[model samples]
Target chain A: MDALKAMWETVPPATPDDLARARRRLIEEMGGRRRLITVPRLLVAAAAAAAVVIPLINGLGTPAYAVTKNPDGTITVTVNELRDPAGLEAELRSVGIKADVSFLAPHTRCAGPRFAGVDPSYGTRPHTEAELKWGAEHWRSLQVIKAIPAGHRIGIHPEYIRPDETLVLEIRDDQNPKVLWTLGAWLAEAGTPVKPCTPVKD
Target chain B: MTSQVDADDATLIGRSLDDPEVFAALFDRHAPLLHRYAARRLGPSEAEDVVADTFLAAFQRRGDYDRGRPDARPWLYGIASNLIGKRRRAETALYRAYIRSGVHPAEIPGAQVEDRLDTLAVNRPLARALLALKPADRDVLLLVAWAELSYQEVAAALAIPPGTVASRLNRARIQIRHALEEGD
Candidate 1:
């Protein structure tokens, strides 16, 4: 046993480069948070001016997004006063999510959010009535119909959301805007155990 | 550069929430020993993957870490052990290869005549014994013998009762002793 221990100890130690590579990997994983710290700090300082000033120059078509956690174990994401969709896309990027939002005129009927289904490798699959019903019944189902405001319209489709994840999205009407509705979607992945919804405060 | 090197694992893990690089100190302290242990079982290439994966996973789950445990060796080793378990086939193959070649690639063969002969005789049988033992028993025995973890530490690492570790150790030791005797 002692000899075995000694023999094992003789194995080569990891080189400095190897350690550096690992540290690099960790930094890569932290890319989102780092951007949040830097970009948002600047954006927040400019937000007041941008909120009031940008509207005059950019017009009322730019979209701004704020993600917040509600007391009811739900997420409230307000995509408001949109002038350009790029700002909303950037905010989603800060949170390590890729999303696209397009605003249409009032009363324009829009399609629902697209999902990659359970198997992205096989390509997109349409949600069946039973599947849609099951998704709705699931605790994390995204409340699409309810979250959209009465006058303002948008289509939401999740191309990729990990399994055992619930995505909560809230959208409000342009007039007297308040978080009137929310969608909770519990995404199920194949061969993975369902995870309970973890309320995320954005 | 950070004074965090002096801080205990629990403290480092707690501080990691605010300053992530603080956790790197923990990796610096533990990774070499972890790499050595994993290399013993899975060789150097796989050991690199195991060590990297262990630290990355540890960093991610630091939020859920039990801060009461000051020394993080057991927790870290436990994570490494789980990763090692996933590559059990590789581990068994390593032992089988050692038995066939009577050469442990990582080991520097002994210089003296008697030491070299003795090592050759014992290493093959040890490799055979390790191969023959159940995974659980081998884990307990190797952790005690090679990693030098105490019975209590072994219990903590494997998340088993101390009594269970003792029983596994006893059973493994008997088999190893018998294997050595047969070699003699």
Candidate 2:
């Protein structure tokens, strides 16, 4: 251990010239212009944006879902759930999309301006069939089919859905909206049917 | 100097963009250590690239730096580790070559005969032990031993929890000690 420590300590220090060259190279890379932003501030800004946007827009009840285009030009659907999160989670599992869900409160607002121009007041509403349908319509218009809840809300945020793939169903306690279940399955790339979520028993 | 060191990584990063001198300072502070670490894993030839790539990436991503930490070595090392991971074949080959040739690419200059031999003996076994460890564990171990980073610094570099750092270090140390004892 002492030898190891000594060895580490004895390692040659960087010379002033080495630093100068590094600075020169960095300056060249910057096109002879030094950067104006610091990394931490940038990270803070990014994190702030992600913290706000991801929860609000990407979280639950928004109209966008991730679509993965397969090598054969086919697309795969994924849904993100925020409302009735547990239910959507179980559904995702039945469909073989291993999902990990977290419950986020609707009132939990993040700092910064919201992107997508959708009103935050719209996000605060309770989950209703009309709202879900409206979300679906908007998502469809945007070419998104799969929906998942992003947080512990009443809305079903679109995660991802293929065009023709079947929806997996795993719902628990049909009578209680608070109950959690899951739905998952592979569907085709277009004109896929929106299946009703069936509740599962313990 | 303390203020400069105490300045958040973000502040330094911002300075780097407009001030060529600041970027050079950052590089001066980090490159030698990064180079030596890379040299240990990859020969001197590839080590330079790793160092260069690390600083370049840091430059590009300076805006995303977390200001909570002032020092940037951990972050730079993390980037270097990623670059090193991409060249896994070369790194493994270098270590295997070292084991065969009984030489460390980053061997210090003008070392005593016994010290050089000792380093070779310890490091050869250590290399094999390092090779045996999971990539994550090896990363933590080397950052501590070779890079001299604190556990918290290693966590920052790897974007892992400090608890994870402790566990990885413990596991890696066990393997290293075992390898040394076995004289492999």
Candidate 3:
């Protein structure tokens, strides 16, 4: 014991020169990192970008998601792959629902306030774990877009929606099998138009 | 020209959210001993990468950091330990080589070779003892011995309960004792 503890006591603490490269890397990363992934902050900027580039999953032309009308008169959206956001939005519109959809790449999200929201539910930013838990608790009861208890499907209740109001769905690829993507769902005001999804660099 | 000399680690981390270069104060504060600890286990070369990855990961996850934890050692070392765990072969080889050559590649060999044979007789066996321990047991032992973290700190670092830290430390110490006794 004492010998084990004392075994390498003589190995000196690293000098500045020893850590210069690592320090440089850290400094470099700090400069290039544009966003801190606080849940609420990104949700606020959901439509902040003016660059209108809808993401298309390259190499495949087929639709990446399916919108099925459940037997109970609710809609089930199963997103098997993250591709063709515009096509998915058009699909929802054809089914008597006006929707704005953004499929975020990993470590990316659109800025918020793209349109005036009907309520504060559009902002799901939680800075800490405690806040995230609190947000999840309240967001669970959201009537417009309820994340179904299973799979990549969300149960959309058309009755809960109002006439002329758009369903704004910002789903990002979390890249986790269990949780899949982080979905931000809220309603744009009945008279207000929701802008295209803007990508916020994280 | 150093600022925030009086700031607590949590405060520094919080401020780094806005003025990110302020994070350099944190890297400056923790990196030296962290690098030394990594160098001891993984040799001087790989230690650099581990230290770099630890700080970068810490910076990214700074948003999720609990401002309540005043000292950042448990968080920083926890990240470093995870990085080191992935390079377990390098760590084991470091110990094995030290035992075989009676020289840790990172250590400056004693001034007189034959004159320090007595020290080698003791240190070499200790290195061999470290090699024979299980990786989890070794993690607990080194965090205690090399990093000098308290049981609570080790538990926080490894995300284990304090009782488990105590048991793992005891199991590791006994193994070290047995390996040394057998080496004799």
Candidate 4:
């Protein structure tokens, strides 16, 4: 048995050529360092561009938008306030589209207050408050619904809007749940009268 | 001043990142044992892939490394095991291929005639037994038997509790020994 063990231990090791090939293959797959640097460099350039463009666009606080799911299971529309900052969700509801409105934070160029209202059921449940608070603080609240029946627009707004916040609006179908849409803008409280946005077609 | 024997793996890895040549030294130190282990399960062709993938993944994920753990062998083995798991079909194919070919890649040439035959006899059954065991059990057993990793290292490599490692190793040994005794 000992002799058998000794023989078993006498296996030959792999060759250097194999190791070299593997190294080369791995380097290729990782796209080499040359490609990796490009992304960070591009980000730096974008930041520089933003620094220049931000001041000119100041006071145009980012717009808040809403996503609405129509009752007929037809479609969801993303309403952005920057371009059409009116009663967008109300219009959609008037057109028989059930809507969910979400207000995102604004950019420095376009600052606005932000607020979010989650269902009390989410926070009031035992052993769930901590989780709900954590989610609310760190991530956006996702409102789930059964189906957007006709004539009801779900209003989504931040708990309160703050300066330099971008308002993001997301809409989803109640049935499939995965059917969703999003619109984002910097909220600008320029006292611009909220105009009627053109009704979105299915 | 650092001996290959004494230098911890993390230190070696850190040095290797700065000086790629230092990596070769690590390869030289660990690859023999790892290759032998791979060769036992996978023939030479696939063993080469396992060794290469192990180091490459290690190099890429080095930033997330826990430097406090000085020995990198278990870590390397863990990565290699993951790579091997992905190629389970390939590994099984190689074993099936070996059984038909009557050749094990790492089996040394020019060994004593009787020893060679005994190795073949012992290993053939062992291979069959290994193939029959669950992947987890096989991993723990082979790391101990082939890689000579301690139960702690096996636990680290397999990411199982040490007690689990002991239990699996015991179970695998019994099965392997039984298979060998039965000549199955």
DockQ of each: 0.12, 0.11, 0.23, 0.14
Model 3 lDDT, residue A27, Cα: 70
* Top TM-score hit: 3
- Compare the candidates by DockQ and give the number of the best one: 3
**Tens-digit lDDT string for candidate 3 (B1-184):** 1233356788878866744555677888899999999998999999999999999999999988889998999999999999999999999888888877777766766557674676787788788877888888998899989998999999999999999999999999998888778878
lDDT of 4 by residue, A1-202 (tens): 2322442466666665656676455444332221100001222344455432111122455434345444544344332233343466465555443333333222111111122222211111121333322322232222222223222223333333333332233232212122222222222222322222223322
**Residue runs of model 3 more than 4 Å from their true location after superposition:** A34-202, B1-3
Q: Candidate 2 recovers what fraction of true contacts?
A: 0.24
User: lDDT for every model?
Assistant: 0.58, 0.54, 0.75, 0.52
Give the clash total for candidate 2: 59
Question: Lowest-lDDT window of 10 residues in candidate 4 chain A?
Answer: A32-41
lDDT of 3 at A126: 13
Which scores better on TM-score, 1 or 4? Answer: 1
Question: DockQ rank, highest first?
Answer: 3, 4, 1, 2
Q: What TM-score does candidate 4 reach?
A: 0.51
Candidate 2 lDDT, A8-100, residue by residue in tens: 344454554534455445545653231111112223244454432222224435543333444543334343433455555555555444333
User: Of models 3 and 4, which has the larger lDDT?
Assistant: 3
Candidate 4 lDDT score at position A114: 28
* Candidate with the larger DockQ of 2 and 3: 3
Per-model TM-score on C-alpha atoms: 0.56, 0.51, 0.57, 0.51
Indicate which candidate wins on lDDT.
Answer: 3
